[model samples]
Target: MTLHAHLTRTVARPLPITSVVIDDAFWSPRIEQGRTTTLPTQEHQLRTGGQFEALSLSWKPGDDNEPHIFWESDIAKWIEAASYSLAKRPDAELDASVDEAITLLAGAQQPDGYLNVYFTVVRPGERFTDLRDGHELYCAGHLMEAAAAHHGATGKTSLLTIARQYADLLIEQFAPGGPLEGGYDGHQEIELGLMRLAEATGDGRYRALARKMLEDRGTEPFYFEAEEQRRGTPGYFGFLFPDRAKLAERFREYNQSHAPVREQRDAVGHSVRAMYMYSAMADLAPQLDDDSMQAALAELWSSTTERKMYLTGGIGADPSIEGFAGDFDLPLHGAYAETCAAIGLVFWARRMAANTGEGRYIDVLERALFNGVLAGASAEGTHYFYGNPMLSRGDMTRNAWFGVACCPPNFARLVQSLETYAYAQTDDSAVINLYVSGAATFDFDGHALGLSVQSNYPWSGQVDVTVNTAPTVEKEIALRVPGWAQDVALRVAGEDHQVQVHEGYVRVRRTWRAGDVITLTFAIVPRITRARPEVDAAAGRVALERGPLVYCLEGVDNAGDVAQLSIGDGAALRDEWDDDLQAVRVSVDGTRHLNTSSSLYSSAKDSVEDATITAVPYYQWGNRGKSTMEIWIREDESASF
Candidate 1:
């Protein structure tokens, strides 16, 4: 496809963040932090963690490798973050550091094109022997993703060459009829990463490669079962893996291959892996036009989102497997919504949007963004939360860092790469997927289409879009009217314009000219949301939400534990901008219900006392000192949340 055609492809594609400039109060500072603070800090962590040192030593052949099992992928994620940071705003030192790592990786590549520091330096003779538990393909997937990011941002092929070589090696081992037969990644990441590689290089074979991998899993004589049998039971296995029975059991529900991807309906196994595999399926659905794959994705998405998802748009209620347990079996304090799961949810949601071009997908994306992903990182952008919970009584808090530091880099990379998800362009139209103060310019049939947007967004409901295109370029611009918004007001150049609202977007079509403007206002008001009665954890409770954000009550703000609070039937909610939280805080008239018996199990009903309190955005909680936080408040009525 020519540049013009590709730029205006009807199918949804992310505009290069480089082409679009984002300078909003909401996102610019976060991106800057990723560039200046987060990237540098993560790079330092990777170096101190001996990720680069391990790869460099693996290349030395005789040296011992002293890094963790998944260090390569951790470093790869940091590299991915650095690549996005560099693209958004270049950093000389960070670029040099990434170059140095890439050079080390280039040297570490085996003559056979294999690249893994753990297998090479630690278990040289046993490469590809532990696909059930090993993360070799997972690391390769992260490297491919990093290479794609580096190539897209810097227009350099050095890293891409390394990734291609590694990919070829993976194909040689795992591809159909390859020497190493029936091999698949224990982790489901490589499939999605392969899709990214295909998009980066425009080689459909990578997509084919991804499809082959997904189709191969959960087949007769499952690779995971065979691997487990080959390794034998606990006492019979090798000393390196002292617990084979436990490891063997992990291959079942923990890896998400208990059944074929298409046959699986409910989300199972690792939350991150489930989302990754499903996202790859969704990404491949439109590309291959596969009906089964599409149906599988739709059913899986509905299964996860409808009954299993949290009010905060989180999944994986069970911590034992770090994944889903059963439908509507959500636990409040024991919620195990990992940061990686939320990131994978964002990935899935975006691909789903691109596949269908529907606002519902973006709605899920925004929920994960404003609540889960945003909550992963701290207000300073340095600390991270690996697990996000809906109701915490001071036990959960963001850590400075982690031994397995996936969330920090993942959060950093996502925040730095926000340009793509903000807006998208079609062949003869464009979609405003997100509301932010920024500008996006793309070519539409030999015409330069520029969209300049200004809005306070989640802070306020008003959004103003200005068009800078030739009058001859007739096109449509669809503004997303959030599902939460009703009676949306629209205007064109100061004149009230009547437009039909469909699905979730307000469509306006006309010949565009320079300085043409469109304004949209969504009514921003606080709403009380309740969960289904089946959610026992949230029975007779409610959550507060304003705009796209979900609000929670923290103990510090209310001067008491949130468990003591209850919302009246006709509560009057008020909004005020809290400088500390950096968001508009909502206060509600409520009651503090307490049992006077002082017994563990009291037969008497709790006494209700008048108490007014404020609630902050769920993402803003824990920013202050450690305190109890609760999402679901006791309802005066019988509404569950």
Candidate 2:
């Protein structure tokens, strides 16, 4: 099935606003200027000054044979950011810098279309020897994405041609009857990327190649075992793969056998790898019109969102592997909710939402974007956190980039792509996934439509939308009323309209004139959410949730073991301004229990009773001097007089 046919049948009309253009208003002088000013890092990395130079001086060509999974991932981010910037700014220096990068990339490409500095310059002979640990395919995937982005931003085909050569090499090396048939990257990303290349270049061969790679994963001989034996279990891949027998067992345990490309569920393995694999599955599912794949994807989505998810929509609860442990294992402080994993959650959610027209997918996406992804980057957009801890200590250090700093550039790229998730489309319908104060104009089904959405969302609940186009067409507009909204009202032309709501979206179909305004109001009620009893981390605890934002108690603002803090039953949550704090603060008649005992981990004494305590939004926590923090707190069962 073609993409257009699938969209016509399943997707709603009026495509969502994708961030094709750089958001200069929110990111311009502040964020863009910051990126440019940070160019010294890029220059240093490219030449001989910063960490890259330091590594390059000691770097032997053979050293590149070792798996440096993120060696090129960082550069891919910069290329994406540069393309986005040049698309919006069209500055001469930006163009020159882009051209220069392209020139370097072109020069670096091998005669066989291979283009990775590590493998090309560092270890040429051992290029495909270590598929289990090496990121050669992963790096190629990112290059393919960057090439597509560059081609889209500018009509230039230089980078595209270079990437095409690399893709050709991949096809030749990994095809069904090629030199390497049983080998697939332990990290699954190139499949989805190669598909994108196929779409961009209109090449059926690339799509076939991508399909072959996905289908060949986890078959016979098990690629990782041979690689591990060859390398004597050296470096990060050992940690990632651990025991070859165990890894193979887990693959079979997850039912990842040789059936079809889309019949797997329950996210497993490295958090990022699982998401990337699922993303490719989603992309290919619709293109192939595979119902089994869609069903499995839906099941996986539900499992993640309904049980194995943080309030912030961040997954991966197992700190050991930095991946999902099981259902409902969300621990606060010990959580290894890696920033890249959260961003990957958004990636999977957006693709599923776009493909299925399901509001639940967008709901998860919004929660992850506003909380999970936002927590990774500072409000200033300069500093970043590799691990997005729901609760933190003052001693916690934020790394510029970790041994796996793939999260940083991934975060930046997602922020740049934020505009795309706001809207979605089908033949005769449009779905608004996010409510932001912006406007989007696009072509769908041969009709030009303009939609203006004005709202102070995440701060306020009122969203007003105005639609304008040629007078003769009728279209169905779907507005998402968030699952958190308890009471929602929709009005068209000052008259209450009967709306059909399913899966968290209110659909209003009407034959539209040039000037039609549809207003939607979602009730933002501050409510307390409790985890299921099986979730030991949140047992006997309640967390405050308003809209999609999760609230937490920070020790800097609320004194002592935030675990023991409790609010009075009749305590009213009122919004108040704190001039010193410089943000909205929540006031509650809550009492703090002082742990009189010397032992830190002791349970609350029998003498403890209900007291007044205050709570604040989790995002606003840590602004003050960090002490202790807690998202899920024990609710005192006794009522206060």
Candidate 3:
């Protein structure tokens, strides 16, 4: 089915607000804090010969690989966050600072439409030559995304125009008939950004270009082959090629070759690259009305959500490849569920929710937002974690920003742009994807509508939605019944309605009045979920889940080595109030078997015994002092004992 038709049937109204509007509260404080502290501190470090900047750009002469702009993904993230902030507060003074950065970008752009300070100023004449390591296109892609976002937020076209010109240069240089024909970025991103540009600007040419880029990849030998040959070795140095055929062949060999763009299952490659490709596929699949592509995306989505994803909806469990290692490879200590990857997952999942109008997508998105993405930032939102470890020891520390601290800014931008993902649209239907206290006003099919949703979600399960629309406009309202809500009930206009729940949504169509109120109540029961036996980490274990939040047992909260702890049978599960955590504490009655003499470096795995293990929402795991944690634990069967 075409995405248009699906959207038409699934969403019949317009989202009152875009993500750009929602993310401000989450983004502005961070920007203000950074402006006064983080940014200046880093700049001081750069100026005063601090180790961070020195180490970042150390690849230069007489120094180690010092902090290169592109080496740390944070540069792009800050740009993105600045774009978001500018969008939310166009008239504010901070916008001027953002404009200053944009001005820097403008000054940084070359006549050829290329804009990389490091490449153009620091190392000239080497453009596109170091495909194995250079991040030219990758940088361009991020800049393009920021440009589009800035344009979208402010209605000013200056940055976007610059980005457009840059894209034009790329098109002129790399189009099938152009100078750089038959090549694709080994670090894929421009394709997705270009597609987003097309959507933002209503330009078919950009979309066509994005499609062409996807189609053009992997056609020839690897784009990096020549560079690798020149370098006398082939290491995954980053940017490799633009050859569509060769890239497709490599993707096929890697088992990502699905029939259409969407069918490519399993995540692979540099975490960012895989996500960018998936994002592009998501964008193009619906626009082109390609079911095969959607199916392919669905396959990939299932692989990640079902078999590969962490409890936080974060992908990429392997630090070695900075990507997914394999199914069920989630090792707590070594797990590299990068914060940026989680942000990317949120990005992809949000698109899927829009495309399919399925609550499941939003469910996953919420999981990522509340846990994986939230974990990236501290409660105060200053310090950040680039890697969201499932389990953390006191040894784990939050860094200010890493050489690759792209995740923090990305988190900032996402938090700033979060409002848009909270709601979705169609001509006559509206679906509320999130339950946050907010009001939205938008026009749908010439009908003026206003929606106010008031609820404390994640912290509370009650959501109240009030709709005000044109008297003559009859609309359907679909409320997402989260997957974790096994027993959900909804009341409209104080009347009990017999509703059918399908695909995670309860659809209600009726004539609406201005003050009509719809209340949805989900039985947010705390339950234990057992993983399939094939999942090694989850063998003989079960994880706690409440609503959409996955619960874990942290050693700080539970007095035992989490790794050796096991839940005994016949233990009653009880909920106790913990004022310190401000959430319900789950207590399980089980015996705690102590292996006091076990050595830390023992070759033999510690034996598990019956014990009372209390688990809290995974989102709250790291709030206490860092300690061992476990999401899944053994469920004892000896209840009668």
| RMSD after CA superposition, every candidate | 3.7, 4.0, 5.2
Q: In order, what lDDT does every prediction score?
A: 0.81, 0.67, 0.66
> Candidate 3, after superposition: displacement of residue 174 in Å?
1.0
Q: State which candidate, 1 or 3, has the greater TM-score.
A: 1
TM-score of each: 0.94, 0.88, 0.86
Worst 10 residues of 2 by lDDT: 1-10
lDDT of 2 at 438: 69
Once fitted onto the true fold, the runs of candidate 2 whose alpha carbons sit more than 4 angstroms away are 1-69, 226-236, 239-261, 559-561, 568-571, 576-583, 600-614, 623-625
Task: Find the candidate with the highest lDDT and give its number.
Answer: 1
lDDT of 1 at 620: 87
Runs of candidate 3 with Cα error greater than 4 angstroms are 1-73, 89-91, 226-263, 598-613, 639-641
Model 1, position 353: C-alpha lDDT score: 81
The number of clashing residue pairs in model 1 is 1
Model 3: per-residue lDDT, tens digit, 302-325? 878888888888778878667777
Say which prediction, candidate 1 or candidate 2, comes out ahead on TM-score: 1
